[model samples]
Target: MPKPTPETLARMKDVVGPKGFVDDAAEMAPYLVERRELYVGRAAAVLKPATTAEVSAILRIAHETGTAIVPQGGNTGLVGGQIPSGTGEEVVLSLSRMNRVRALDAGNNTLALDAGVTLAAAQTAAEEAGRLFPLSLASEGTCQIGGNLSTNAGGTAVLRYGNARDLVLGLEVVTASGEVWDGMRGLRKDNTGYDLKQLFLGSEGTLGIITGAVLKLFPRPQSLATAFAAVPDVASAVKLLRVADAVSGGMVTAFELVPRIGLEFVVSHVEGASDPLPDVSPWYVLIEMSAGSATAGLDETLEAVLAEGLEQALLSDAVLARSEAQRADFWRLRETLSEVQRLEGGSIKHDVSVPVSAMGAFIARATAEVTRAMPGVRVVAFGHIGDGNVHFNLSQPAGADKAAFLARWGEMNALVHGIVREMGGSISAEHGVGQLKRDEIAATKARVEIETMRALKRALDPKGILNPGKVV
Candidate 1:
C-alpha cells in the first residue's frame, strides 16, 4: 500500500472532525510509542471515531486510497501491536471516542458494549448490574476492550473465567474492505455454519477491527479469600495446585507462582510493598477463592488445602489475608512484578505456556538452559500457575551493560522458545504475535499451521492494508 497523501489525510479527517484527528507528531507521541519501549511507530494521523459509522467511513477512505491502517486501543499493549507503522505510511485508528456501554442484559448475563470502552468501565457496568465480568488484567484500567478481544487477553482469572475469546459471545467488526459485519448476538448457542466472531477475536486487527462486542458475565461472588504460600519447588507447586483444585471443588479463582527473586524485586522497588510470606522459600504461590454465596466456605476450603499441603511437606508456609486491604496488598506484590523488573535493568521477557502437568519441568529446564547461555543472568520468573502460563523474564546481571544485555534478546528467545516448542507449549501464551513475535511464531509453528494462517489472511485481508507488517 502507498503512503497516505495530504489529500487523503484531509478527506479522512472529515469522517470525524478537526478535533477527532491528531496529525502533529508531538500530539501523537503517546500513540506512537508502545509501553514496553520495544517499538516507536509513526502515523499520518490518529483518527478518533466516535461511532461505528465513522469507523466504517474512515476504513472506506483508507481502502480507496490503498493506505494501510492500524487499529489502536488504550495504547497499553506490551507487544507493539497497537502502534502504527514507523514510516508514517499508515493511520492509527483510535477507538477511545466510541467508549459507551450499549446494553446490559442481566437475564442473559451479557453486556454489549463499544470496543473503545475500558475494561475497568465494563467491569463497573457488570458490577452495577449485580454481575461479574471476570476478565481481569493488570492493564484493565487503561487497556480498552477492543485490544483485549483482539489479543485474546488471558489474566489471573483464566483458571476459572477463561480468556477474552471465551468471555465473548458475539462481536461487531469492521472488515478490511470497509464493510461492517454485525455478528453481535447474545445467544448461548448459535448453529451458524461458521463461527465468524472467532476470526477477529484474536486476529490482532489483521483481518478486521472489533467495533463492539457482547461480553459474557457471571454471578458476583459474595465470599472471597486470598492466600500467599511458599512451596518446596516447582514440582511441589504443581502438586499443591492440584490439591487446591480438589479441595476447593474448583472454587479456586487465581493460582500464581512467584519465584523468590521476583518477590525481592517487588519488595525493594515498590514502596509500601512487604513480603506476604514470613520467610521466602524457593517458590511462592498466590491463591484466591471466591464463591457466589456467603455460605460457600471458601476460606475453610482453602485452609483445608493448605493444611493438607503442610502435612504432605509440599508447602513451607502459608498466610491468608485477614482483610480486603491485606488481600489487595498481596495482589499488589504479584501485579507489580513486571514493573519492578525494569529497575533491575535490561530484561528478556517471555509469555510462554506448557501443559499443566509439565509446567514444573519446563520452568526447571528453561531456567537451567538460559542460565547456561547467559552466565550471571538474573531470572525473574512468575505468572499464573493455574493455567500453566509463566512470564519467565531474565534480568541483567549486576554491573552488566544494559544495551549489551538487551542485544541478546533474539538469541535468548530462540533458546527459550525452542524448549517451549519441545514441551508442547506456545511461545506466546496470552500476548498475541504482534510485530514482536510475528516472525518468531512463524519459525516455531508447523508448516501446515503457518500455511493455514496465511491462507486465512489472504482471504480476509487481500491487500494486506490492515496492520501491514504484524501477525500473519
Candidate 2:
C-alpha cells in the first residue's frame, strides 16, 4: 500500500483532536519500536484515540485514504505485530488514552473495560470486586487488554483459565471499514449465531481494531500454593505435572518448565533471586495451585503431589512457599528469566508449542539439534509446560561475537523449527505471527489454512489498510 497522503493524515489527526495524536518524531519514537528492538518502524503519526467512536473515525479516514493503520497497545509485544512497518507511511493507532474500567459485574463475574486498560489494572478491578481476572503476563503492568486479545496471549495462568480469547466473552471491534461491531454481551452461553469475537481475538489487528472487551472473571482464590521442584529431566517434569494434576484434583494453575541454565541466569543476574532448593538439578518446574475456599487444603494437596513425585523419582527436591512474600519471591525468579537472558549476550528466541504429550521429546530433540549445529551454544528452553508452549531461547556461545551469533538467527530458527514441525508443533504459539514469523508460517501451515486466513483478511480489510505486511 502507498503512504498515506499528508492531507489525509492531517484530516485523520483532527478526528481525535490535538491531544489525541502525536506527530513529533521524538514523541512518536516509543510507539515506533518494540520491546526487543528487533524491529524499529516509522509512522506518519501516532494517534491516541480516547474512545471507540474516535477509533472508528480514524479508521474511516485511513480506509478512504488507503493508509495503513497499525493498532498498538502497551508496546510490550515480543513479536513486531504492534509496530508499524519501516515505510514511515503507516499511522499508529495507540489505545493508551482509552484506558478506562467501564463496568464490573460481581454477580455475573464479568468486567467491561476499554481496550487500553492495563492487565494489571484489570486484575485490580476484578480484585476490588471480589473476583479474579486470571489472564496475566510478565508485562501485566504495561500490556493492554486489547493487545492481549489481539495476540491471544498465553501466560502462566493460561493452563488454568485459558488464553486471552477464552477469558474474553465478547469484543467491541472497529472494522477496517470504520464500522463498529458491538458484540459486548457478558453472557455465559450465547449460541445465537457465529461467534464473531473469536475471529478478532487472535487476528493481531489485521481484520479489525479491538476497542473494548467483556472479560470473564472467577472467584478469587482463597488458598494458594506454590512450589519449586527440581526434576531429573524434561520427561520427569512432564510426568510430575500429570501426577500433580491427578493429586490436586485438577487444581494445577500453572506448571512452568525451567532449565538449569535459565535458573542460573536469573539467580545470578536478577536482584533478590535465589535458588529455592538447596540441591542442584538439571531441570526444574514451578508448580502453582489455587483453591476458591480457604479450607481447600491446597498446601496439603501440593505436598502430597510432591511426595508422590519424590517416591516415583519424578523430582529430586522441592520447596514450597510458606508465605505470600516467599511466593512472590519464587515467582520473581521465573518472571525475570526472560529479561535476564540479555545479560548473557545475544539470544535467538523461539516461542513454539507442541502437544503436551510431545513437549518432553520436542525440547530434547530441538536442544540436541541446535547444540549439534552450533557447539557451545547455551540452550535456555523454558515456558508453560502445562500447555506445551516453550520459549526455546539460545544464548550465544560464551565469548562469541554477539552480532555474529545473532546473524545466524534464521539458520537456528530453521534448525529448531524443523524439529517442531516433525513433532506436530506450532511455529508461533502464544506470540502471534507478526513480522518475525509471518513468512515462516506459510511454509509451516497447510495451504488451506493460509488461504482461509487471507480470505478473511480480504473480506474485512479490502483496502488492506489495517496492519498491512503483518500476519496473513
User: What tens-digit string does per-residue lDDT give for candidate 2 at 315-375?
Assistant: 9999999999999988988899999999999999999999999988898888889999999
* Model 2 TM-score, all chains together: 0.99
Top lDDT model: 2
How does residue 302 of candidate 1 score in lDDT?
Answer: 88
What TM-score would each prediction reach against the true structure? 0.99, 0.99
Cα lDDT for residue 419, candidate 2: 87
Where in model 2 is the C-alpha error above 4 Å? none
State the displacement of the C-alpha of residue 292, model 1, in Å, after optimal TM-score superposition.
Answer: 0.6
Residue-level lDDT tens digits of model 1 in 254-288: 99999999999999999999987667598999999
Model 1 residue 123 lDDT?
98
